[model samples]
Target: MQIRLGGLETSEVAALLAEHVEDMRRYSPPESVHTLDLDRLRTPDLTFWSLWQEDVVLGCAALRELDPTHGELKSMRTSHAHRRRRVAAALLDHVVAEARRRGYARLSLETGSPAEFAPARTMYAAYGFTPCDAFGPYVADDFSMFMTLDLADQPAR
Candidate 1:
């Protein structure tokens, strides 16, 4: 599969973001839903990407700059048909590498702290992310699980 820079023009990407937001709503309370909408994802600070194989969209993810040395992983979603195919992991690997390329000292994310999000938590753990206190504008919330990876500590993957 190939991964490319993503914009808001494609219908498939639009649909994916719609489904992602809907799923987040279904799984979390309104106050706990942190998934970005299309407009929010288009912000200058966020760089989005789409993973594809020939013509099929496998998944999409984004990295939002929190500061010069930090980034937040956003909108991580693998298409239903692509689940268990390692699409999310591949996309994450790319994001981490990009963070390192950008000289980011850390990469962090916030995911639901429920059973529905267990797979994501496990995957992030496998990539060296560990539970951490919230950063950026985030506040303490039981429903949100924050994780971070220290880019400086990682040997080349």
Candidate 2:
């Protein structure tokens, strides 16, 4: 699969993002939901990416610079057609590498706590992200699971 910076033009990338929003609606309550829609993803502080193969959008992810040393993962979604094929994994790896390259000392994320999110939690665990208390503008919510990964010692590969 190929991953590249995405342009906002209602393309496959937009479709994947729309799916992410739908997933949020399905799995998370309104108050507990934390997702960036297309407009938010286009903000100056965030860098969005799209993963594609041929002409199909396989998945997408985004990095939001919360501060100089910390980065937040956002809009990570694997298309239903590409589920379980490591599309999300590749996008995540790309974001982590990009964060390290940008000199971020830590990478953090917030995902749902429902059963629909168990797989996502496991995937984060596999990448060395451990559960943590709320950070940034986020507040403590039982439906939310915050995780962090320290990037201090790991060299970019």
RMSD of each: 0.9, 1.2
Candidate that scores best on TM-score = 1
Question: Could you tell me every candidate's TM-score relative to the true structure?
Answer: 0.97, 0.95
lDDT, candidate 1, 1-157, per-residue tens = 9999984678888887888888888888999999888889888999999998987788999999999999999999998878999999899999999999999999999999989999999999999999999899888687899999999998758
TM-score of candidate 1 relative to the true fold: 0.97
Tens-place lDDT per residue, model 2, 64-136, is 9999999999888898999999998899999999999999999999999999999999999988899999999
**Colliding pairs, model 2:** none
* Candidate 2 Cα lDDT to native: 0.89
lDDT (C-alpha, whole model) for all candidates: 0.91, 0.89
Q: lDDT of candidate 1 vs native?
A: 0.91
